[model samples]
Target: MKKSIEEIQKEIISEFSDLTDWEEKFQYLIELGEELPAYPEEKRTESYLVPGCQSRVWVCPSLENGELQFYADSDTALTKGLIAILIRVFSGHSPKEIANASLEFIDAIGLSKFLSISRRNGLSSMVNMLQNFAKNSGSEI
Candidate 1:
């Protein structure tokens, strides 16, 4: 069976636990960004751009085999990693699962306290956009 979102969150938290320094954690996130699947240049149009982030972010959501799949990219590596975390949790999940997901893992990983206020707000915006997609998808399902 597939792991629950909570399990994924816990795993992330555990992974971050090994890196005590903020800089180490920061680098780890950037590494995670590097792991993101290459995003298509053709899809970077305004239609896919996520609003409310200081850095440009593009997200494409699609339904495949009854699961929601997300493809995303960001202008900045840090932001890309942030979105990567969200994608890791929500991708391959049903619309209901995505819509109901919580970002508590951010706190569990001690990330929320360290991010700049603007970054935090941007993260919230990212969540809102993805959740909007999930909610809309749920209605169609």
Candidate 2:
């Protein structure tokens, strides 16, 4: 009964469609980050730290039955929102599905263009981090 990854991406795209400018979209993204659940201080260990990002990001990825459960937080609001967006697509899906996800929706929504070069690199790093977790769990992306 759950939505597929494409469905989620399309929904996100639709949400962005209502905003006419990048500034508005950026604000919306910040709102999303603000709504993210509080991360426990205990889980902010080095093991959860994501490297290569200007802003510190901590992600705790686990599997429930066969689906991925991604718990993430970031020191920067924008980065937190970026992680939230990825979580919406990858969480609750099987590792193989996550591995195979296109994620071209990022471009479709013009997300990367609005970000700075370093942020884009950080975003890519976050994606790689998640995909690496999927691969480590035995999914072939």
Candidate 3:
């Protein structure tokens, strides 16, 4: 079975708790990136291209029986994992919940401390894309 968001959050926290430095965080992100599944070339078209990322990203979210599902791909492995993290946080949530989610969750998890300025910006852009999709689709969150 797929892990729940709470479980994933716990795992992330546990995994990163021992790391006291930014370099370790970068290494951790790269390690997480290794776990992401591959994104097909066809999915990397213009419509899915996320603006503000140094790498190409494609995020497709759909609602099934009132639950949101997300599929994402990125040219960069680390970015792909970042996409996965975003999906874990926002997928399956109502649009309103996603839109209302505090950035504090990221900070609480120590993600912001480890992320570079560019990576943080990229993450914000990704979140915006997810929120926009949710709004357009009329999901509750």
Candidates in order, TM-scores: namely: 0.95, 0.95, 0.78
State the C-alpha lDDT per candidate: 0.88, 0.89, 0.74
* Residue-level lDDT tens digits of model 3 in 1-141: 856555666666776677887777667776766665666667778888889988778987778766677788887878887887778767776666666665445776666776789988898899899878877777354
lDDT of 2 by residue, 4-102 (tens): 999999999999999999889888888888877888899999989999999999998888889888999999888999988988889999989888788
Q: Is candidate 2 or 3 superior in lDDT?
A: 2
Q: Tell me the number of clashing residue pairs for each predicted model.
A: 0, 0, 5
TM-score of decoy 2? 0.95
Candidate 1 C-alpha lDDT tens digits along 54-76: 89999999989878899999999
Task: Give me the overall lDDT of model 2.
Answer: 0.89
Clashing residue pairs in candidate 2 (N, C-alpha, C atoms within 3 angstroms): none
Candidate with the larger TM-score of 1 and 3: 1
Model 3 CA RMSD to the hidden true structure, in angstroms = 2.8
Give the 10-residue window scoring lowest on summed lDDT in candidate 2: 132-141
Identify the candidate with maximal lDDT. Answer: 2
Q: Model 3, residue 46: displacement in angstroms?
A: 1.2
**What order do candidates take by lDDT, descending?**
2, 1, 3
